[model samples]
Target: MTELAVMGPKESEFVDRMGLYYERLGGTRTMGRMYAWLMICDPPHQSLTELAGELGVSKTAISTVARQLESGGMIERVPAPGRQHHYRIVSGGWAQVLQVRLVEVRNLVETLDLGLAVLDDSLPEQRARLEETRDFFAFSNLDGMELLKRWEEHRKNQD
Candidate 1:
C-alpha cells in the first residue's frame, strides 16, 4: 500500500486524473483531489490534519470538503476512541455515487411527466420530443437500478 504523501509518479498521476475526472462531474477541485487521495491512501484512513498536510490545503478546507463527501455518501468518517477524526472511502463508493445520480434521474423524469401533462398531445412536434425525453429518462432509471442490483450480487459473491 502506498501512502498518498509518498506516492511516486504513477500513483500521483492517478490521483491527479481522478481529481480531474471528479471535477468534470461538477465537484469542487479540492474535494475531488481529497477524495482521490483517500481512495488509494495507505492505512485505509487518514485524519483531517493528515489529509490537509498531504493535500497542502487548510484544515478548515479539509473539514468542509470531508463533510461534503460524507454527506454525499462517497466516504465514511472513522471515529477513533481517543484520536482525531479520520476518513476513508465508503465500500462500493462508486455504486453509491451512481445511486445518488439515479435520484436525479427520477427528479428529471417527474418534471418531464408534469410537462408532458401540460403539453398538447394533439400536436406531434412538441409533445413528441418531450415524450422521447421522458422515455429516455425512464429507461435510464430502470437500467441504473438493475445495474446496481447486479453489482450488489457481484460484491456479495466477492465477499
Candidate 2:
C-alpha cells in the first residue's frame, strides 16, 4: 500500500466535509476531497499518484476526476517535470463554476419555455407551475450575471 500523506485531524475533517458538500452537489466525494486537499496542501499542486495516495484511492479514479474537474473549469492540469501530470485548483475557479451554472440556468429557462409552449390554455394550473419555475430561474440568471460583474469589478479593484 502507498503511504498516505499525514494530515492533522482538523484537516482530515475539512476534507471529509468538502467531500460531502460536493457529493450533495451531484459530484463524487473524491472530487471534492481532492480539491480541498489541493487547496490546502503545502505544495498547492499534486500529481495523480500523490492525490490517490493522499486520498486513499486509486490513481485511475483520481485521473477520472481530474479530467472531470478540468473540463468543468474547477481545476487545471499544470506543466511539471517528468511523465507525471500535476494539477492545481484554477485561480478563480469558483467564479468560473458559477458562470457555467448561470449558463445552465439559462438553458433551464429555455427548456421551461418549450414545456410551456406545449401546454394548452385550459391547463392553467400546470402552466402556472411551469411559469413560476421558469420565472424564478429567469430572475436568478439576471441577478447572477450582475453578481458576477460586480465580483469581477471587486477583484480588479483589489489588484
What's the true lDDT of residue 79 in model 1?
A: 80
Model 2: how far is 12 from its true place, Å? Answer: 0.9
Model 1 Cα lDDT, one tens digit per residue, 2-107: 4445666786788778788878989877888888888778877889988888877899999999999999888999985556899999878789889999999999
Query: Can you tell me which runs of candidate 1 are displaced by over 4 Å?
Result: 1-5, 81-83
Task: List model 2 lDDT by residue over 65-105, tens digit each.
Answer: 99999999889999988899999998889899999999999
Candidate 2: segments with Cα more than 4 A from true spot: 1-5
lDDT of all predictions? 0.87, 0.93
Judged by whole-model lDDT over C-alpha atoms, candidate 1 comes out at 0.87
Best by lDDT: 2
